[model samples]
Target: MREIYNELKRHSGKLTEFAQVLVDRGLYTNTKHCVAMMRHSTQFRQDVQDIYAEWKPGKLKTKDTATHNAKLAEVFRSIKKKELKEKVETMCEILEETLMTVTLAIKHSDVRKLGEVKANIENILYGEKQ
Candidate 1:
């Protein structure tokens, strides 16, 4: 149970960082114009905010995985811009891979492998060669 909670907490942190990348990339905005013109306008900002809120460090010690997954799916579905949507979807893939890597590391008790996975995740997220 502790291992599972740790893994979930790590993934949540990654998701928050990814969300910031989206904001930095202009994929998330407080601008009403962008929100209004975008599809699923009503849920856009709030969805992003909810993700950030729920995933903040020290906040996921006891969260329901199913609920978290559902919220993430909704946020992805709310993205209407083709390019931004693709980027977000790609980020989602990265997050899934990171989660799997963490789980595997915990299962095998492989600390070195966990470090490698973390580095891989960073490279993927930042578009850096490693």
Candidate 2:
């Protein structure tokens, strides 16, 4: 579980960097750009789901009681880190929000509406004041 969590943290960091690049490239509107962003976001979401599927909580049992207790303690400690959990949750939220914005932009054919959505996404991704 710790390993999976660490992997998720790393992936989230990568996603942040990727999102910055997309913002830099001005690819925040239009169907093509939205599709590209959605592809990356979808891939990350699926990867997380796959990791979650493989994670089994409280499954680490051992013949040695002392070792089993120690392992359990370690797992609990790792999972109890509030900051790490919050960061993961925030990252997932950002990705989902971006995907939703892109889907909306794709559905609306009005250029002005797409531009507004793009501006909103920029603010969301970059913390820019709107």
lDDT of 2 by residue, 1-130 (tens): 2343343345435334433444555545444453345454533455434534554343333269888899999988888897678866876786677677667767875455556666656766676784
Instruction: Quote each prediction's TM-score.
Output: 0.34, 0.27
Q: Residue 93 in model 2: shift from native, Å?
A: 1.1
Tens digits of lDDT, candidate 1, 23-105? 66576664343333333333335554554455555644677899999999887777656777797888888778888988888
Off by over 4 Å in 1: 1-80
* Candidate 2 wrongly placed segments (more than 4 Å): 1-80, 110-130
lDDT of each: 0.60, 0.55
For candidate 1, give the lDDT of residue 95.
79
Q: Which structure among the candidates has the greatest TM-score?
A: 1
Candidate 1 structure, TM-score to reference: 0.34
Judged by whole-model lDDT over C-alpha atoms, candidate 2 comes out at 0.55
Kindly give the stretch of ten consecutive residues in candidate 1 with the minimal lDDT sum: 34-43
Give residue 33's error in model 1 in angstroms: 58
